[model samples]
Target: DSDSKQKKKKKSKASRSDEDYVQSLNSREDRNKSWWDDFRESVEQAEPEGTGKFLFLKLLLNETCEIGDKVLVFSQSLGVLDLIEEMLKIASERGEGLKSSKGFYRPWRKGRDYYRLDGSISGNKRQNDIDAFNDTKKARLFLISTRAGSLGINLFSANRIVLMDASWNPSFDTQAIFRSYRLGQEKEVYVYRLLAHGTMEQKIYGRQITKQALASRVVDSEETGRLF
Candidate 1:
């Protein structure tokens, strides 16, 4: 009994040590400025990195606008969606042929060239937003929540889709992509999945691929057996 108690205490100490080490590693700053100062500066500047998803979004939006193609941007987090909204607002103010209304983000007034859909949008309002994007050629971009737009929404007007973040569940991403390939979709659709290399996002994407491959094999086997 004394031996078992000693082993338990040792295990607890080991766990605590691991936690402390992780915390220390995380706390070590890579930049000269403190974390809070860096965060504040980043918010104020809002300067997107060259290879980052935000920069890619800007390029894609500009190209799509030139070609008169629509785009749907999906993110799982509301905070990210808000940031994107702000980016669009800034872009619009810079004579980018986009606009933002004075108040709430909902029903964003951007010269009829942009629309937004999220969980906050009601059924009717969501449909209205979708219709506005689909029915009009002026609408060039639609920002949506990954969860809210992944299911039962037909966004065939947008020939391009952008996954701003990766989800652990592969089905969510698949659903979001397929939303643009609905029944009335006549044009070829392009889907862009943005993931930071050497980060957790890449790891999550790898997991998603593994799950999809396994599921595909299972479905293929069942079909083959039925054919035999």
Candidate 2:
């Protein structure tokens, strides 16, 4: 029994020594880190304010939503939509109870103030959300994936359309814009295309203009042939 107790005491002491060694190593590592390393760590941990394009979008939404105007925001990437949703949530929280053109503006809520539609959502849920947006007085913003929303959906309630990012194909964006500019839409629809100055988005926008011009020429030629 005495031998066993001695063995246990030694094991306990060794374990404590091991723990101290690990703690010492961690402290040493921290001390050895350079100022540049610390700065990099801080940058990594910092919360970003979002891209300039999205900041402008938040401002536009603030202006439009304050005036009781409904908006449809379409993006080619689901990831971009997700980012916009998070940014809008922050904006809503910040603008809570702010006075607007239409009296006091309430904080934007998920199902009441905005709706999101992506390929992952079920058809029934999509239709339900669409119906809600069209019928509800408070529903103002719709964040949609361009591919998922460009076809077979009518957002006649919204008068403002924001193309968050330009698509490679101009037809996709045209369809997205027309989603709000449908037959039942009584208000004049305005489309806003957001593009970064020095990025591939500008190139894509230029390409879209070229493609649209070519498409128009082709259609005109075909119509003339039919007439002949």
For candidate 2, lDDT tens digit of each residue in 1-228?
A: 999999998777546412333333444455456444545556332312345677677778778867778999998766566666667666557664223676665666788788998765677999999999999977878998787788899889999999988989999899999998989999988899888888899888888887777777886764212210
Any runs in candidate 1 off by more than 4 Å, and if so which?
Answer: 1-36, 39-44, 48-51, 99-111, 221-228
**Candidate 1 per-residue C-alpha lDDT over 101-124 given as tens digits, one digit per residue, 9 for 90 to 100:** 332122335537677776556679
**TM-scores of all predicted structures:** 0.73, 0.73
For candidate 2, the TM-score is 0.73
- The 10-residue segment of model 2 with minimum total lDDT is 17-26
- Relative to the true structure, candidate 1 reaches a TM of 0.73
Q: After superposition, how far is residue 59 of candidate 1 from its true place, in Å?
A: 0.8
Residue 144, candidate 2: Cα error in Å is 0.3
